[model samples]
Target: HPKFDMVMHDLLVLLKPKFVVMDATFAMEGNGPNRGIVIPMNLILASSDLIAMDKLCCEIMGIDWTDINYLNFVDQHYQREEAEPQIIGEKIEDVTQKFLLPYDDLAVRAQRWVYKNYFLTRLCFGTPFLNMLQGCLNVYRKVDEEIMGKEWVNKYWDNSLPR
Candidate 1:
């Protein structure tokens, strides 16, 4: 549990990716991946440095980058001698949009607790009936996609970003 963050950070470092291209256009906040409030942040971000890019993205998103685990892990492990990235387009102040964070609601908190708790995990997860949860989530995703993502999909097809 303790070294999990370090392990993940190490794995990313090991890959040594050349560049990062982030699509912040139609970013999601709150509970994400089909079910969330979508922010129409019409900007594409790119950087040769992943960590610097992430830090800049976090600033643009109006959140503290230090709060993120992998970023924090890197900060803790590596020296802070690296210089910040230079912005070529919109200033962070002009584009900053504060997004509502996910997993803060009671339901999510309870779900996280249940999944993390040993006894609850053994009782709840070690069952064939638990497969229904996936099915239910899939159904929810489809419904959400139809309701919310449909508009975005249509807009994307038409190349029309909502202003």
Candidate 2:
């Protein structure tokens, strides 16, 4: 939660974008922002308000906006009473589709638990630990590719994308 909050809120304060737009035509589900199943929704979302945009995205995905940790933090920090955002295009209710979330049931609970716990957050995000954690993940990815084959490695990884 610390890392997510840092990136979502704190970093935004330092480096705010002029606008935010998301391609929701095919949204990812299950352990997202990484490996996940894609669902076709045929919609595009855009807003100057990042928080509002994100909340609407979650709603369109048929998930509770509050279920996301960073969103909850933003909601509280901003003192938001309602989750409604001004709709400029398609109505969210008309396009809502339930997406299968990431991780097993136990893993989901464990993830939430870790995010909510201060001790766990410190252990995961403190000082040089985050860098070390990233390094470990990199090593794991290399090992996974070698063992499982490089089917997921993109042609663009080395700037060899087909024109």
Q: Which candidate achieves the best lDDT against the true structure?
A: 1
How do all models score by TM-score?
0.66, 0.59
Candidate 1 yields a Cα-based lDDT of: 0.79
Candidate closest to the true structure, highest TM-score: 1
lDDT per residue as tens, model 1, 1-163:
3356688677666886677899988889988875799889999999877788888888877789988887888877754347667889888889998988776678777767887777786666777656888889999999999999999888776666575
Least accurate stretch of 10 residues (summed lDDT) in model 1?
75-84
The TM-score of candidate 1 is 0.66
The C-alpha local distance difference test score for the whole of candidate 2 amounts to 0.75
Clashes of 2: 2
lDDT, residue 44, candidate 2: 82
The true-structure Cα RMSD of candidate 2 reads 7.1
